[model samples]
Target: MIFSHEFSETSEYSAGTYTTPTDYFRYTLKVFEPGRSVAEPIMTIEEDYAFLMDSQWIAQLPEVREESVSAAPNELIVYFCDMFPFQRSVRDDSTRLLRDEIHNYIHNDLGPGMLEAFRIQSSDWGFIWYGDWTSSRPGADSERLSVALTKNGTWYHGRAPARGHSWISISVEGGVNAYYENLTDGLISAFYHELFHNLQRNMSLELGGNANIDGKEDAWQFFTEGMAVFASSIGMTHVQFSQTTKARAYLAEANKFVAGGGLLDGELNNSYKAMF
Candidate 1:
């Protein structure tokens, strides 16, 4: 069984308004609270009664868990759907680590960093699906989020719907080991790359970009993918030389491809290579 970890449900939320210093636009957003409690339940009936009766028992209990279940005021709620039962070990190990890494980066690191960088006072909220959207268990918001989902038979590692643009779908088809060469950093960078796409979409609306994103979809692809690629670079920078070396090599290869008339616009136009 998957042990309990901190997670926020989309349902239990407090509404708040976010406004930039420029007063560009006001957004009503939801701040999600963790659905599960962190407190360790007293499994034994005798222990439960003893804990309530004795103050010493409280002191003896372990410190509260450091993992946060609540989404920060300016963050998105992420739900993981493990689609491959055959990859259970992969999910339990590397995938779980990836989940925590993504969680900490988004909620603790990136959100506050964005607020400071943008002079935004209002919170922004959305959801991210970190596994197959189709295989999501009931109540994972899969039904309502039918707007933009990963294409059924398309070859992709990750995508956020360009239309509704609220959620991101990350494909874990071959497990982190096979897909990412067993590199956790590689997995983190990949996830962050897609996450930055969602961020770009949200920030676009916040700063008054066209709501009809598809109308100018071709024009936006360069900037959209560029920002995400840059963001992933930053995400990978913590490891300094290791992943950065590989990423630079990849970028160089892409540069060569672009020099040969490759482009980052539409799916038909070699956009995948450019974005990756």
Candidate 2:
């Protein structure tokens, strides 16, 4: 069944707050807007998101359901929002396909290989923000976020800040087919990239490093983004994932901008470059 837990803004160890291999999972409405509860949704988006999550078929799939309880705390807890019309048919179909792809990737890649290589277990509990969180936010930026929760095979809607959580955010703001050949393919690539970020977080924590460079366009950004790019390159093919090429194109422009004496930090396009 789906479970809902409230965390105090000041308390770090509440009832539902969990400790994964990466860090503590604290629930919040938005990272920037702390203490905002789903009780007060931005629009009707939270309720719309709940309707979609309630009817999902993947949560019932025997194999996936089994994996849902896997020891790996790094497994993805994906949430979709701003789905244009927010209907059951569209949300169900999208969620079904998305879950299938995620299961395959984790079962084949992250669980057995990547996490194994790092001496960690399979499937860490982390949230992924898929689709647009804002309807009129303008531009496809701000889509890279990690949010939400689920329990006992039931999904619940919420946002967990990426800073201290093993969170992975993704977005296809314009349309499902806007970034890649299809939404599923684009999401897979994005998941791979973010999964690497989680690994980076865990490794850093193990090394006693608590530095976070998210949103900063500095040299350290390369270590995170570049490593993710490298991981995605070696882990999956981007034939159906067109955003890779798009990010590469932007990176080329970013290179020229820096070569022309533009500072890597504070510029906008560099954010896009850092995303992929």
Best by TM-score: 2
Worst 10-residue lDDT window, candidate 1: 52-61
Question: Tens digit of lDDT per residue, candidate 1, span 222-261?
Answer: 5555556566555555442354324342363255435444
Overall local distance difference test of candidate 1: 0.35
Number of the predicted model whose lDDT against the real structure is largest: 2
Give the per-residue lDDT digits (tens) of candidate 2, residues 90-116: 334553334435445434532333233
Model 2 clash tally, residue pairs: 11
Residue pairs with clashing backbones, model 1: 18-122
